[model samples]
Target: MRFIFKTDYDQDVRLAKHGGHVFWYGLLLLFLLASPWLLPEYWLAQLTFVLIYSVVGLGLMLLAGFTGLFSIGHAAFLGVGAYTQAVLSNMGWPFPLSLACAGLLSAAVGVVVGLPALRVKGIYLGIATLSFGFIVEEVLARWESVTGGNGGMHVKEPSIGAWKLDSGEEFYYLCLVVTVLSTLAIVNLLRSPTGRAFVAIRDSEISAQSMGIHLARYKTLSFALSAALAGLGGALYAHKIQFLSPDQFNIVQSIDLLLMVVIGGLGSVHGAFLGAIFLITMPQLIALGKDVLPPVIGQAPGLQAVVYGGVLIVFVLFEPMGLYGRWLKVRTFFSMFPFYRRGMFKRQKSFQKSDRLK
Candidate 1:
């Protein structure tokens, strides 16, 4: 086991807690920087998808995992960003400006959604968001003038000035830079007062209110920030796929994004990347299984969905803390060795205020 002896208050919020973190993360960074040369083109492409989804996962994690907000329509924000980027890029807008507009427009929509969100929570909030998603999908499908409607839209390659990110290698580096900056931004946000306010709200809105946290302002802010990140991810996604369709950002995509955060491990930044990896690789894994399994089972149209659903159920029931949580347990077991206890990380039961009143 490792222990830290902190002499300063700032040490508590330091990004790197110890030498181990620095060493491991530094090594990982070095490996990622060189991945274009080390990985095959197909794998590199998949990794790029992973990075894009990771950005989306981080946004979802901040809202669902930290702010205790549940959304089933986040894909709407994604679509907003995607269409915005697609339209703007096609109009000869620079990549940076288009990307910024995508995020900003998504944030604006998020604020609108957040207005309704202030009145609801739990499943009701989910339903409201889900409805919003459906509305956005309909708009995308029918609004032919701006969005290209059901025919879809083609996105140009992202370029800054005269330099175009035309190759997979160049695009991968761009994604890497964005993902790194997004990760750092989230990490720093979590270290700030607003981030602490988010955690407080997640734990208990009643308690957070008692502590003078303006519920409406913060909630709206959370939605805007979350939607902004989702939009940014969507902007990247549009460029990666270079095409956009209304169906691409439908309910199923939202569920997949939610599943990514949950399976990756909610409430942990590491979970976002881990979940992205799982999300990106899962379809490939299913494809590989098709060759080995019986044709009736493996070749079924719903096989991938069934596998995804099964994995999600297993994670929710048996590993709520997610992949990161499971990793923590294993790390603790090995570190503690003979002294390890089975129930050391067990969940605690708590009653709601309504239940207590009864």
Candidate 2:
């Protein structure tokens, strides 16, 4: 009888630890919704950028975290989505429907790009995607009218019936909705068996193949789905920023997208969202630092970039699991504080004892 009570108590602790994440997510939602009214326009605009970046970051999460793809050219797909929206909307297609088409176009391209994944893995594949992103940018630049040449293309404001999303605050709400929806989609996908298969493939493609998972098909689909989500984010960004430059969707942005997933923590849906907000917010904070610094750092604009690079290096070297990983550890420690004596208990033992109740 006493053992049964212990098992139930441990199970309750484990459940609360996992369940608390939902509460934190809810709090974040309320904060994002209130930001436009609560923060200055500049700050609100940054937050809106975070929402857009989060969508792209989620795609990176799907590829790198779940599938272990290590892709750096994810933004090429973003450009594909944005350019499609720009060209179609300019051609007088209705805005809402065209956005959906943009996702399809990006997905189609992703399937083609994903073909190489059947043969290549690791850094070689990363370079291949990087090359693809460059090619896409070049095409956008050389294509003249479709992409408006190197001068770039201007995008129409997004509209729904009588409503136009012109104000940053209005756009903020749009981005917020997309961010929330994209994260939910990722969560649902991760919970599904297909998502589990992707994780399996990530860990061992050979084993997964032996276990009856179709390698080429799942690989292609994961790439397509990731690109489709990136495209969705890009389409929204095109509408929000009111302009589309091929330069904005180049390899640099792709690397930045990869960095977000890495810095946020791979394999974590919440990490993608958290990373986007941090990466977006960090630059603005750095800019503020430049203003306050006396002279040494201000003389060299490169210092900011250096600092950013250094931070990424540190995270990669010491905390490859990223900030979300650290957050998990902190939660674990605090949750065990009352019951654990100087951390003497084994992690698996604690976990196993708790699991017996379930």
What lDDT tens digits, residue by residue, belong to model 2 across residues 1-358?
1122343556643422354556886787788888988999988888788888888888878988888887878889999999998888777677678788988999999999999998999999998998999999999999996899789889988776677777888888878887787877887787678987888898788899999999898999999999998898889888877888889988778878887888898877778877997788887788788888878876686876787799899999977668887676565568776664534434443644322111
- Candidate 2: the clashing residue pairs are none
- Report the C-alpha lDDT of model 1 over 167-209, residue by residue, as the tens digit: 9999999999989999999989987899989988988899999
Q: Rate the local accuracy (lDDT) of all candidates.
A: 0.91, 0.81
For model 2, state the Cα shift of residue 194 in Å: 0.6
Please provide TM-scores, in order, for all candidate models, with all chains considered together.
Answer: 0.96, 0.88
| Candidate 1 Cα errors over 4 Å, as ranges | 347-358
RMSD to native, candidate 2: 4.8
Candidate with maximal lDDT = 1
Counting clashing residue pairs in each candidate, in order, gives 0, 0
Judging by TM-score against the true structure, name the best candidate: 1
